[model samples]
Target chain A: MGNQKLYKGSLQTIILKLLAQNDKMYGYEITQHVKELTKGELKITEGALYPALHKLEAEGLLDVEVAKVGNRLRKYYKLTENGTKETANKLAEMQEFLKTMQHLVNPKFSLE
Target chain B: MELTKEQVLQIDNYISACGIKYYDVKMEIVDHFASILELRLEEEPDLDFKKAIVEEHKKFSNNGFKKLLEIKTDSVHKRFFKSSLKHLFSFFTLPKVIITIAIFLGLQFIMNSISDTEIFFNILQGFALLLSFRLLFNVNMRNNNKISFLSLSITLRFFNVFHLFTILFQFLDNINGEGFNNIHLLAYMVLFLFYWSGEYVYYQNKKEVQEQYPNVIV
Candidate 1:
């Protein structure tokens, strides 16, 4: 929440990275996983999460499987082949972005 | 703690009452509500089901859900159009490509040979109407399940895709040629391709939706 604006751009990358690690994830599970990973630093609101998931799915980067869980049907999303390739590409892009940001915004520059 | 069928139905009714009618959309929300309600009910033994659902629904406000539907419609249609074109291009392979080209040339020949081009336009409009009716029927049959998928709802457009052809009528009228020119030929080819692509899309989309959501509503 504190750095939500900063994290917003990386939401899709975050999702792909997560799906790449975990074979598949549903809506709530992705949110909870991020919370657990970030130790609550980032909370994925349902409002922001579903649209991202659906968009990725539409772009053919994700595939969905609906399963009956207990009394309700759960929609699970897994990365497609395109999604896997895209994950690698996005992560590489993110890495380069972070390096650039570190140099510009948080450089370990000390006055010599 | 798991929710009872009655509890799940309560969530379904609550979501349906909230204007989220599509099963594909509601399934995720209902599951979210169920998962959270189960955890909440377990955490508090005396919490009311209505109260538990309300708590979860507040997290995803009605406006948020509306925003979700808007994004969903835009994205799904993009996917729908893309998938249709993908399927259309799939015909460009062996054996089938032969048939495709043959049928295409055959139609071109017919267009060139026919003295009255009116029949071709009539067939085009009729075919377009037929597609609308077939896709409309698909939408209805899907709705018969009490909860339809959102993609099916996108097919509810009555007209306008082929309305451009009407303006072409005036273009056709001004021409003093015996047969269609390359311009007119190109238009007919595009319309035929749209007609074929739409048919294949309608067929494939129905299968995909049926596969996506089974009869059980949650």
Candidate 2:
């Protein structure tokens, strides 16, 4: 697994990106999807995921829909208009940070 | 494999046993717990359900469900606060300002006409008390499986206005019973309108949640 502390700041970015693509997802699905996509290298604990989701909801960055599926109510979160805009900004910011980190860590390396 | 209604109830009981008793919080955890348990059952056909539940519960953070409940409550409180502020601000702008000014003038007129301020103070306190009772009455009118953190937090936001009154009471006591001054009237206006706007916003939020989540009470 990747160092979680390093990934901590990026959790919101990662979640925003996923919601952008998937339209909507519930709590467990987000965690499972992240783990599956990263091949178990990234694991989102319930502790981190929920607070982030609730924070986003409070900020009006996301909207929630609760549905009865099988025997339980599942809260599906979708990006608001502001959340979509924020996702783009966050993605750009993450890309810029990645580029800067790469240049600083390996000055001699060139992707070109 | 889908959980039977019995299994779902058992899971709800298990989460409640873990001390996360709020209905909304329990609903999320119960569903997540059952999902993981069912996945485990699929992977290992002979897996013990009770043992699997314990293992899955361990997978939650060290603080477990209590931590989730805390953060969720905090978020709900923040949202209600933000909404209250928004409502209060709206009265300061556009068409609503007219109504706000009228209410302030009406209160000012009453304070000016009264010879003794004590009666005015008592009437104001009675009005505040009435608002509190009305809020409680509205909540009691709703039927719920159990109170969710959202409902509790929203209801509490209305009561928080009373805390401001407490502060004023303490301030007045410190000053040794000074009669109602102009400043006091202005403070009462702000508090009264704030309480009114906050009640409007917070109660509306509770109503929306009740509509959205059938199991959650106002």
Clash count for each candidate, listed in order shown? 0, 0
lDDT of 1 by residue, B1-218 (tens): 99999999999999889888887788898898888888888899899889878777788755758888888888888987776667667645687557666877877788778887767756754665565565446545556765566775564341235445544554664474445455655665666556555556655766777787765541
TM-score of each: 0.75, 0.79
Off by over 4 Å in 1: A109-112, B90-146, B156-197, B214-218
lDDT per residue as tens, model 2, B97-210: 688788778888888898987678767766766765665565433424446565555566465656667466546745746567667767666767666666666566666677
The CAPRI-style docking tier of model 2 reads medium
Relative to the true structure, how large is the alpha-carbon lDDT of every model? Answer: 0.77, 0.77
Q: Give model 1's docking category.
A: medium
lDDT score, residue B171, model 2? 66
lDDT of 2: 0.77
True contacts kept of each: 0.79, 0.77
Q: Give the lDDT of residue A21 in candidate 1.
A: 100
